[model samples]
Target: MSTANESATANPTVLHFSADNDIADIYRAHLPPGWSLDALSAAPDEAEKLRKVRRADALFLTETPLTRDHLAVAERLRLIQRQGVGYDTVDLDAVRARGIPLAICPHGTPTAVAEHAILLMLAAGRHIVRLHEDITVHGRWPKWDYRSRTLGLDGATIGIVGFGRIGQEVARRLLAFGSDVLVYRAPGRPPLERSWPRDRVRTCPTLNDLFAAVDIVTLHCPLTPENRGFVNRTLLERMKPEAILVNTARGALVNEDDLVAALRERCLAGAGLDTLTVEPPPADHPLFSLPNVVLTPHMAAGTRQAHIIKAQAMFENVRRVWNGEEPLHRVV
Candidate 1:
């Protein structure tokens, strides 16, 4: 990670302390005229560096863990702006203790992640990987046999776990494909009749109900300590034998070991994962050997359009905090 500081008048500084410099540039370009922007590279003494720059009004954080010690020195810090939707890496408890706002770019992520989830569903359902390998690698022509195993979205019952921005977007697209959408969110929330007709979209009271009923399930929830490994063997067993599982959300939400076992035993038909319990997983990871799994390097929100939108929202929230207004998408 590298760092750069942009000087602009005597305005409060916004620290760009993330691994990606491109994100810093985005912040620099969009921030209001007088606000200062500073980029800090990841280092062994990162906490010490934060101590030195105790006047940062906001932090655009990615991958770097904001420990309690770092927060103690950041007396002037008003907001911690996550570059993307997930804040699993940040110490939320400490952030709240300081009364600082923690905001995410929710608007920027929905379209890209939702589209990726649908893409994965189609790829896994159609056995695209295997068919491509058969033709391109083995020189086999026209692998029509794959068609028998392929599943279609039309008339399929799709369950979206977590009815937030990303989940709702996934539901919208699936509806156009003529799929029945079932959503499972926390209890006590109002029905989603406003977004979709009550007759068209059914609500599942629990994960078990959703898993048992849907032909395909996509995860769009954030990863938190309480929900870590929520999709374990017992819940997975409830899914239909031919059902496809798609996850564009955090990897730790699902038990990767159990997922592999389910796939190996043929209890589950297929899985499309953009994230893993461990990113850049080891070469010998079991999922890599499975023929029924499709994997991407957690790039569900990596679209160019998403990046620009995310950057804009990230700094906009910072500007909001500076202007003494409540930030958008405040998680803490």
Candidate 2:
């Protein structure tokens, strides 16, 4: 038998997976030079996909949902390696049922994601993306849009909705612009002003305080059942009419319908969203019609550096599994 078969029959280990094109390349680069990787552009039909995955010891995924059925067929599967922080795409309960450890990149993508959030904030504040599209795509060169808008970052207050790693990094970048920074984090997890320049940024006493006081509110929190619709009508109503909104964190955190209504009523000045309530929001989604809303296809961690870090993180976890060591970044 061939070495692959010998290994599969003897150790039952193979790295099986799917990931975005760029992420997949990074994964490949992190592996040994001669190692081969199997990839599926899209998960094929069940029997076929299972046949392709049957001998695998681990699976790596990004974006594609890994349900119970997907895991059930991989009899030798020992680990599930996720490319980034969020494991929502991988069903934890299913992994538990099969006794497979799930791993994610622990120190992965936060810096890149944080940078992306700051970029979104600036883009939204200044209508940067919209203006660029007008100049390049619509041939509106040599001038600005008749209804164009802009917000000066200097002397403005930026409210961070979550003060996690990415949120703190966003705060770090905001400091360069001399903007006043206010943060709203879970109780007992207040902002650490010492970690950042104390002269400019300050911590808010409450979430409402941050919402009421800032010129721009950027979301950096995760999506959970309790906070899924956190940015609904009530919260949107609390913002200053001219306050801009930015979310690079996750989609479900905001109530899309309420946001659309707020935009329609002109309650919000504009928004920059790298994520949406659903990935690739339907073409007819109401948010698309708003001239002030800037939407990206969740490309915040799209940089090459971020991709390499993610790949390394996944490989580290795979190595741990191969050696019978506990996987890092276990989600469930």
Candidate 3:
């Protein structure tokens, strides 16, 4: 309940932008006493909110962005700590232009995301989504003539697009399932030098080769400008007709319309997506009608464990900034 100016012991004020009340509470608890905490339902835009009133010394931004316009008015803003690993929402170029420090909680959501990817893969492969829908929409349904389908993880090649922390964790998990893992990271960046399980993974020379080789392709890369629509018609066409695709990464990485077309034409077996170009897509979206596609409302990193881990990491970054020390996960 303590407001910003009332506590004189803490000179600089800190504002947290999180819609979730529980997340705000955890952040507040970790902040040093006397440093004020203000929760906003959304990211601020106008100068008055960012500059005059909130007086944010450091910002903990959630889903919404901290754009150049937003940062322009925050004169005292020294650090922008992201709650999640992805920094797409934050304007990194502007932050770097202003010489402001930015940090991300990479360790927070990797495990949850990896687990969710595996869950989606299983759900799509076993026809769990369609079976459940049939049970609820009509009644308990019996097996159809096409029920002989089975997707075993053993001996299957799981292709991972990126070799970041989350991708590495996915590789580790899939290895335990007796699966061969193929990677398409920048060449010469071998995993053995970094202590990762290189024995279980083979590096593909290019994305095209990776797509042609694997039984299942799981995306773990960021949706940068270069890779925004990476999984378009051509890439999807190269995938084995019976191959599966999994995405716990950014939604924009896959072109929705193209994916829908591929599914309709049976170019690929199915897709399991934890994200879409739009969150909570309209009820009438075409993806809803596709029994071959399994969709989730961007909950790849929404686990309880992930929540605690992200909150802790965010606060630790704040603590380091508050104490005039270097932050652990500086991204910019």
Please name the candidate that would achieve the greatest lDDT relative to the true structure: 1
Q: Which candidate is the best by TM-score?
A: 1
- List the candidates' TM-scores in order: 0.89, 0.88, 0.88
lDDT (tens digit, per residue) of candidate 2 on 90-156: 7778788878877777465788888887777777777777678888898886355433466867888
* Stretch of 10 with least lDDT, candidate 3: 1-10
How close to the true structure is residue 191 of candidate 2, measured as C-alpha lDDT?
44
Worst-scoring 10-residue span by lDDT in model 1 = 1-10
For model 1, the local distance difference test gives 0.83
Which runs of model 2 end up more than 4 angstroms from their true locations?
Answer: 1-16, 133-149, 188-193
Candidate 1's TM-score reads 0.89
Residues 1-332 of candidate 1 have per-residue lDDT tens digits of 11113222245678876643676776677777777888765554765566544868778876677888888888777788887888888877888888888888776689999999999999999988888898889888765787777888999999999988899999899989989999998777777857587776888888988999998999998787789999989888998898999999989999999999999988779999999998779999999999999999999888878878877777777666666679998989
Instruction: Name the candidate, 2 or 3, with the larger lDDT value.
Output: 3
Q: What is the C-alpha lDDT of each candidate?
A: 0.83, 0.76, 0.79
In model 3, the runs with Cα more than 4 Å from the true position are 1-12, 29-33, 42-53, 143-147, 191-199
